[model samples]
Target: MQESVFCMVVSRTRLIQAIACFLSLYKTMDNFKVYILCVDEKCYEFLKKINFDKIVLVTISELNREDLLAIKASRKLNQYCWTLKPGFIKYILTLEESIKRVTYIDSDLFFYQNPNVIFENQPYDSVLLSSGEVFLPMYSKEVNNTIQSLTGNFNSGFISFKKDIDGLSCVNWWDKMCVDSCTSNPEDNKFGDQKYLDDMPFLFNNVYEITTQGVNIGHWNSSKYKFTVLNDTIMVNNNKLIFYHFSGFRIISKYDIRQVHEQDRVNTPFIYQIYRRALEKIINDVEKIDPDFKGYFTVDAVDDN
Candidate 1:
């Protein structure tokens, strides 16, 4: 009886997330409940401005209290990848609690295209993420192989899963991989947790692959693809890209040209525009929430640099 109720509740939560994902696409609301796992207060505060009441805000502290007893073992190796442990641990705990089925988008990404389609369209029991084509080579060979051993697939930016023990197991698997003391190959440390996540899909049965354009598109190496932007509509090939991950690059002002140059620069006009608009939105929204919030970026500095 308990299992049946839990399944039903998860089904409902996915529906809510589906609807929220669509609404987020339309309005670009940072208010979605799924964003509760963020460890960055500035990002969270900016999100809090737009939809103060509706943002599904959860602090790192609230999510990782020692009392949870869920993943206390991971506490010690927190040194291995402390920046990621809080969010990853929280994701595992949340999935275990049956609070919701989870999808994690990195802080460096911004949604321009509706991700609802990505969530609704896939048939897997879980979604294994890989860094988009632009960024995968940034990892070393050893890390990549280790990841494949774990998931038989590679990705980290946008992972989707149904809330269940299997999901928690996968999350736990990732936590262990991040802190694994097994080998100290110097190359593995170069990519950090991302290289560790490459093998995630193999850990469980319901694994689905999210195609290249669906998530995490940007200038790690994204120049080969053609980009077309017609007003607010952006497309790659004939199909639109869902979101662009602004990894290792910074947008100076909302309308500024991207600061990072890659071989794929000329081809991604649509993605460039998405980065511009999203950056502007984040900066503007942050000030509305906290008048005192002084972010480092300004029009002149970003434009000049």
Candidate 2:
């Protein structure tokens, strides 16, 4: 049997992103399942209705952790998802034995090529992370590189690990770190849950960075690479565009999408429109199930403050 590979993601306000992420994976990839830890009961109930066979929905009640329960008091609303990542992976591993590997990808990820590019090429007993670089245009060199230099050179958008002694140990260590001090503040070598990933190479054996160029393209590195979509094939620097992390994509309205990719300067890729359309389609479909369903993007909140 093919190795039971899985992908885990968290969705609170960005329910459409998580839905779009799984839809893209199910449509593009051949193997594996995507597990979602809906950050609230509402998100969970909505996902349950869609009932995608390959997608499994998890909730906080299932996790049964006092640690996660305490997060609400200390962490802000947005930081909650980042904090749940490591613990979510640990939860899946414990629930299922056949899952030999798990790749935690951001809910905003949309794919055009097989994710197998990472797993098929992975050597025995190795942990995998994608490099947060390709080549940067001169315009992006200063700020982008400065942050990369400080926060480690890898993007935690997509992380993969094989089931083994070392892999579990690494995930556990990361879980502990996030629970204790995961923050957006990059102080004392901390910047969200991401900076901790900087140590993966020095801390573990057979840790490999992805050679797949199109795996995690976003604004930070997108400025450096050329993206061309020919007859439905999106290529990045002469390789198949595996996945594009639509990190800061915003729905200004149903017809408009604001592409704010991190703090990087980018000549927006055509993939943005394609991804936006997909999310729009999901929102429409989901709203049909429950007309009252409102996404963070769809709702317009007045700034009363």
Candidate 3:
């Protein structure tokens, strides 16, 4: 079996979510390796103790790049994490000559099925990008254009790069762009490392947007699909749900999770329940490793209105 390579960047604030993501992947995928870039020492130490199978833990210091270290003090924590995404993927791709492809996934993404479906029909030399197209038709053209300009036409949460000329060129350009300027300011036509993807198709050949519906089902577009559970399988518009990006979902407490997307509460309550249970179990397991481990719990009041 060909090994699938994946990478993610995580910190203490996203420790629980990252573990949940890994568990979900473990349940679904076979012959895969995940390289986790721990952005903080606490996250690194905690994951070291757990020592999950098929996972290799890395630290920010392992990068050891002068450019990244110089800007560490200037960039915000979130922006700094975003900045590391491309660099981290590039790092992994270089670490192993046998690694044919490397997919970068956000720590908050949970998989329901094998992600090989996303790679079907994709050329080995092509770069795969997740489309950020919001299926809701309620937004006007102006609103849609604004959202595209701000967030870009592609989501950076999940991107696959083949170890070929086109893929290397794309990732290298992205890494350079992010290292130079990865700010959240939209005024400069940059929204972290995400907006830089808008120029990929125009700048490079073999760049394709992933059109698989269930590949990136998330809050931004979940409202547009009719989700149903059949025979223990979650389906989105008759397609098996591959993965769900819990972009803004927050854990207010052990028993309470605040769904930031209003439409998800009404359309995908069952999905949320599954994730809640998974998170609770992950929390229990984490506590076993470190009883005092309290991370990612938010104190914000939930607004039901």
Which candidate comes out best when scored by TM-score?
3
In model 3, the Cα lDDT at residue 264 comes to 31
Summing lDDT over every window of 10 consecutive residues in candidate 1, give the lowest-scoring window.
1-10
lDDT of 3 by residue, 88-184 (tens): 9889888877888899999889999999878875755469999887655567878867877777878899999988889889999999999988886
- TM-score per prediction, in order, is 0.63, 0.90, 0.92
lDDT of 1 by residue, 25-44 (tens): 44653334444443346544
Q: How close to the true structure is residue 68 of candidate 1, measured as C-alpha lDDT? A: 32
Which candidate, 2 or 3, has the higher TM-score? Answer: 3
What TM-score quantifies how close candidate 2 is to the native fold?
0.90
**Window of ten residues with lowest summed lDDT in model 2:** 296-305
- Deviation (Å) of 121 in candidate 1: 2.4
How well does candidate 2 score on lDDT at residue 16?
A: 78
Q: For residues 1-305, could you state the per-residue lDDT of candidate 2 as single tens digits?
A: 33555655554466878878887877887766777888877788777887887877887778888998887678864566778888888887777777788889887788788888677776574578877763556555677667776666788889887778778888888888988887766688887778888887788777788875678987667876788867778898788889988877765445655665443544567777678788789777877888887555533421100
Ranking by lDDT: 3, 2, 1
